[model samples]
Target: MIYLDDLLAATEGRRVGPSAPARFPAFCYNSRRLRPGELFVAVKTEGGDGHDYVADAVQGGAGGVLCQSPPTNPTVPCVVVPDTQLALFNWAAYALRKYDPQVVGVTGSTGKTDACQAIAAVLSTRHTVFRNPPGLS
Candidate 1:
C-alpha cells in the first residue's frame, strides 16, 4: 500500500479534488485493468493520453489519480505533479526506499540490466536484494 503523504512527498505533488484516502492499494496505468483503490496514472504516451480515460477509470473504481492535471469537476482525489511519468518513477523509488532504506543504482549506456542481475546474484548470497531490470514484467 502507498500512503498519500509519502506519495506527495515523493512526487512533489499536491492534492486536488475531494479528500483522498490515507493509502492506495496499488497503481495502474491502464484504466481497463485498474482495480478499486488503485491509483491511476495519467501518462501522455505516444499511443494515447491517459488523461482522456480518467472518467472511465473512476467509474471502474479507482481510488485516486497521479496526474499532471486534475479532471474537471473531479469525483476522486488527485495528486497533481509537473510530470505524471516522472511522478510515477519517483513513487517507485520512494517505495523501494521505504522497504530497504539502502539502495544501489547501476547506470551506464550499455549492459545495465546485466549488471543489475550480476549484482543481485552476488548480494543475494548474504542479503535479500530486489533488482528490477528494464523490460521486466
Candidate 2:
C-alpha cells in the first residue's frame, strides 16, 4: 500500500524548509497524530509554519516528513511541497487507493463514540474489527 512515487509527485513545486535526509514513511499521519514510519504533513498556520514540528514528529517515530520546507533533523527524511494541506489531501487520496479498505468516516456533535462502538459491535460479528482508542472520544 506504499505509494512513494505518488507521494513524490504530490510534492512537486513544494517549498523546502530546513530538514534532514530522505526517509520512507512506515505509515501515514496527520499533523496532530504521528506513528512510527509515518509521513507527517505540516500545514501552514496563520501564526507560524507547520514545518516547525518536523523535528518533534521525527522523534515520535515518523519515518518521513512532508512540509513546505525540509526538516531540521539530519536523520529525518522530508519532502518539500508548495502547499502542505493540499499535499495531505493528495496523500490521503493516494492512501485510499492503495489500502482500499472499507472506510467508515464518522462525525457528530454528540454520541459519536457510542455510534462507533455500535457499528464495531455489529461488524465484529462478521469480521475482525479494530476500533480507535477509547481516549479518542
lDDT of 2: 0.64
Q: Specify the poorest-scoring 10-residue window by lDDT in model 2.
A: 13-22
Candidate 1: segments with Cα more than 4 A from true spot: 101-136
Best by lDDT: 1
Q: Write one digit per residue (lDDT tens) for candidate 1, span 1-137.
A: 77888999899899998876778887788899888998888999889999999999999999999888889888888999999989978988888787664688777788887778887899989985555534342
Residue pairs that clash (backbone atoms under 3 angstroms), model 1: none
- Candidate 1, run of 10 with poorest lDDT: 128-137
Q: For model 1, what is the alpha-carbon lDDT of residue 118? A: 81
List ranges where model 2 is wrong by over 4 Å.
10-33, 97-99, 117-137
The backbone clash count of each candidate, in order, is: 0, 14
